[model samples]
Target: MRVAVVSESFLPTVNGVTTSVARVLEHLQRRGHEALVIAPAAGSPSEYAGAAVHEVPAVLYRRFPVGIPTPLVHRTLADFAPDVVHAASPFLLGAHAIGEASRLGIPSVAVFQTDVAGYARRNRLSAAEGFAWRVVNLVHDKADLTLAPSSAAMSDLAAAGVQRLARWGRGVDLDGYHPRTRFEPEVAQLRRSWAPNDELIVGYVGRLAPEKQVEAFSALRGVPGIRIVIVGGGPSESSVRRALAGMPVTFTGPLHGRELARAYAAFDVFAHTGTEETFGQTIQEAQASGTPVIAPRSGGPIDLIEHGVSGLLTDPDDPRSLARAVTALTGDAGRRARLGEAGRRSVLGRTWESFGDQLLSHYESVGARGPVLTRALRKVDVD
Candidate 1:
């Protein structure tokens, strides 16, 4: 099958959406399918061996690297003429994807990966932020199928009138990220030079944006014997530091390869405060490293955590709840060890191979008109 995967963000810009999209494109290509990408030329697509990447000209917001803010990629997608269009983000690029698919009489799909409105709410916008949900539905309304990454997102898409919705879920690279001990002589040297021994290092990974509620880092100020470590660089880094009142936080500026693995290994527990993750991935990475996650009981984390089993899901808005959860996980060595061990295998079913096999089934059923056959059967029953 000729597939076109369209998105505003791609590799070179590290985030969950880009990572997941890249993986999907890889799978399609590995399965002997021709896959092309329509996205901004901001990043390198050479990583995917057999996939063709066609970048369109677009303007990225000066302050925000996560989005292009405004773009018109319709012409690009139309030129590609793919049999199936997979819209990774349901914004301008997504609209173009569905529009081109319709013109070509092709099956199109949209993947829901983030909660824009919840992001807005975290940024302090109330009523105006509600439009994210509306926009999500409007974009997918044109698709033959819409794939939501999480059950929480599925409920929202359904409420917004996306009738033909199914879950594609998310996956983690089990090999790229695995349990690795021994912080090496170099990493250990860097760690010793940055932080002293016996400092309870608590790690937070992902963008340092306002929607991420990174200011919540201040909540850790009162946690005794704790050193806050932020792993990703983002727009709000300076503001976040100011909000933290020069609190002690070591920003490793996004580690890759073994350093990243050790970053996960070094942390005693994972603390993610963002309420808008479609599926918080750092939680999975931390878990893969046998590190317990202390996440909020909102958005996708609710689905990722089982509270006291793999990790503890606390109140998203309550810093006290976050503190308590983190405290509980870190306080007891035995409990943390058990939870982390369980979390190591938490992603047993959520893998790329599994996701791709299931998704291929959906694509085949779409091509075969399974829905039409089902309705026809229902009518015969009535007869």
Candidate 2:
């Protein structure tokens, strides 16, 4: 089936939205399905996995591109005439696209990946919380189906009065980020470089944004025998660096693909500092790498962790909970190994292929009532 994926962010951004969209594009390409990408113009590639990428006007907001409203969305949809529209982390641009799709009598699937209301709370924009949720509700309300990545997200959307909601989680790269990577020569060398005196590595991977609460890692300042590794860059880099000052920490800016996998494999414990995550993608990557995880008992992490079974869940309200969880695992190699192994086992069959197929099923079910049944899966009309 032909699908048009409208994402709030895309390549060169490397956040959860971009990562998931890229994986979906790759999946569609592999399954012989035609696809098109509509994203913000932030130096993204012209094409991905054989699908042509159409960029729209965007403005920099907090150092990230935020797609602005444009007539291009309506024109593009009218031209391509996809069977279904997949709105990835629907926000301003996404809401507009969904509205356009509805006007064109096309079905849409809105994926609720970002928590804008939660972000408002984190940024102390309490007044904007209601407004944010209103926008979220309005955007998702138009879709034929709204896919939420976690129970927390589903609950939030439901509370906002969004209907036609379904729980859809993100997939991990099983082979790329596996337990075997720990034994790789490159990973070993990298670990040695980060922890010269053989310190336990407590790592955090993801953007250093304000809503991410990355500064929470500051509580680990005096922690013993653990080197903190911060991967990924964002607007909050300077402040986060200041917060982690005088600690045994190393910032790797950002690492992708094999390097990102190696970073996860080298960690003794993966510490996710973010509290507003709609879906903890880094936590999954850490689990896939056989690294014990410590995430706050909030948002998406709640669904990903089993609290002392597969991994540890800390108190999101307590600033010291993260540091304490890391301390508990720092001296216990056996426990960490057990937790890591369990985490790896938990995600064994949760691959992109399986998730992609699940997505196709959703498309088929939704498209069955629309133009997809009669129209052939063909190339999009660029003109």
Q: Write the per-residue lDDT of candidate 2 for residues 136-188, one digit (tens) a residue.
A: 88888999999999999999999999999888898999999999999999999
Model 1, span 132-229: residue lDDT tens: 76787778889888888778888877887778988777777676566655345654665565568666678888888776787787877777777788
Q: Per-model C-alpha lDDT, please?
A: 0.73, 0.89
Model 2 weakest lDDT span, ten residues long: 374-383
- Candidate 2 regions exceeding 4 Å error are 368-383
| Predicted structure 2: lDDT | 0.89
> Which one wins on TM-score?
2
Lowest lDDT sum, 10 consecutive residues, model 1, at: 63-72
In candidate 2, the residue pairs with backbone N, CA or C atoms under 3 Å apart (3 or more residues apart, or in different chains) clash, namely none
TM-score of each candidate structure, all chains considered together: 0.89, 0.96
